[model samples]
Target: MNTLLLIEDDHRLANMVSEYLQQSGFTVQHAANGLDGLKVLQSTAPALVLLDLMLPDIDGLEVCKRIRALPGALAQTPVLMLTAKGDPMDRIVGLELGADDYLPKPFEPRELLARIRAVLRRHAPGEATEATHQTLKFGSLELDRDARSVSVRGDVCDLTAYQFDLLWVLAERAGRVLSRDQIMEAVRGRELEAFDRSIDVHMGRIRAAIEEDAKAPKRILTVRGVGYVFAKQQD
Candidate 1:
């Protein structure tokens, strides 16, 4: 059973969510606040985290940052953020903070379950659809599919599980400019919200990690009104 950690201060909601997830064949660990959630994370090592933006201690954004700072594989643990319904800013910020996905509050249990499964699938190692070759090289930059790691000149680049998948999609199709919808379809297969900028945010994070100069990126180039393309050659 895949264990999951839920960090929500509301006991009633947490109980309901935990019960629902338990019925869905998941082991649920509930934490009421950010600090407790971090502690539970270290002890439980859940497959994913369901983080609530509003916490009694540090907000979910801070917790997300802290999680990304953790050592080793733990730092790449999938994060599914929960934000207030209709609060697009919080959801965008959550994604910018390295969340794999976000489900706005007061969401249907089924949708939550679907989102969780989707994020987990994207982070799963060595899926059959993965390229036969385990690694790809672009000049000094390297992407190791088996390790789910990216490095430039032997220096590891920090990226969230989602960002890694996003980068993988672009790197695998180097020299091709892909629209936002195409990229999303290849990665998570989620419907883009009207005026949604989540993909752009993830791309910004990816560029920050891999590009020598994010503001004047040479590896990943924006097509202005179109989308983005990973440069075929890099140094």
Candidate 2:
């Protein structure tokens, strides 16, 4: 069973979510504030964190930044953020902060469970045996699918699990312009919602990690009003 640390300040909501996730086969741990959440995360090292954006103490974004600053595997742990704010900017900020996925509040329990499972699957090891011996290369950037690792110019790029998958999907089809819908479907097994900018946010994050100059990216090019393409010629 996967363990989950839920950082939420609302007692009633936390209990409800905890019970629901527990029934879904997760060992759920709860923290009412960001400080306690960080402590629980370090001590328990849960498989995934369900972070609420509005914590009584430090905000969720700060917590996420701290998590990403941790050493080793802990830094790359998947995060699924929950927020009552449905603003696209908030969602984008959360994704930019290294959240694997984001779920706006007023969500169904089933949707939350689905998001949790999807995030976990992206981070799960031992599922890449089929591609164990294969590595994809684009210029100096190397992606080991089996190892779930990426490096540019022999230097490792710190990418969250979801970011790596997004990069893989793009690199695998280098030079092809992929619409937001197509990319989302291929990577997340889902369609893009109207006005959803999560994919754009993730793409920005990916470029920041792998591109030589994020402002004038040469690896991933924006087609403006269409989507994006990974340049075929990296030289």
Candidate 3:
């Protein structure tokens, strides 16, 4: 069973979520605060982190930032944020901080479970048979599906697991203009939150990593009023 580290302060909510997830076949380690969560992370590597945006001590956004600063592969650990606020900005900020996904506080247990599964699937490597087409190239940019790594001109690029998947989806269908709905559909392989504009934020993050100049992105271009397309030719 996959393990999940939940950094939430509400005792009642925590216990309920823990019980719900446990019933779904996941092992959950709960931390009441951000520091404790970091401590737990240091001792154990969970498949993913379920972070609450508001905490008694340090906020979840700060925790997410620190997680990304961790050494090596640990920094790439998938994060699914829980936001009590209905503000779209909170979700956008979490996404900017490398969160794989986010669900508003009043979320149904079933939706939460589905979201967790989807995030985990994105972080995990594809099936063994897909290894034949594992590495994708676009001039200087290279993506290794098996390694879940991206590099530009042999130099590695820093990207969240979710961002990498988004880029990979576009790259695999290079030259095709994909609507935001289509892109998310292809990436998740399941129904998700409707065509959220936050996808633009993720695209910006991906370009900042792999593109020499995010201002003049060449690899991924927006078609205006439509969606984005990964360029076939690159230099």
> Which candidate tops lDDT?
3
Tens-digit lDDT track for model 2 on 15-125? 999999999899999999999999999999999999999888899999999999988778887899998764767778888988988998988999899888888877886
Question: What are the per-model numbers of colliding residue pairs?
Answer: 0, 0, 0
C-alpha RMSD of candidate 2:
1.8
Q: Which stretches of candidate 3 lie over 4 Å from their true place?
A: 127-133
lDDT of 1 at 216: 93
Better of 1 and 2 by TM-score: 2
Worst 10 residues of 3 by lDDT: 125-134
Instruction: Name model 2 segments beyond 4 Å from true.
Output: 127-132, 191-195
Q: How many Å off is the CA of 32 in candidate 1?
A: 0.7
**Which is the winner by TM-score between candidate 1 and candidate 3?**
3
Query: Candidate 1: where are CA atoms >4 Å away?
Result: 127-131, 188-196
Can you write out model 3's per-residue Cα lDDT over 46-106, one digit (the tens) per residue? 9999999999999999999999999977788889999985678888888888898888989
Model 2, poorest ten-residue lDDT window? 188-197
Quote the lDDT for 162 in model 2: 79
lDDT of 1 by residue, 1-235 (tens): 3999999999999999999999999999999999999999998899999999999989999999999888877888899999998888888888877898898879899889988898898788875345575888999999988778899999999887778888999999999999887887787646543335688888999999888889999998999998999998757
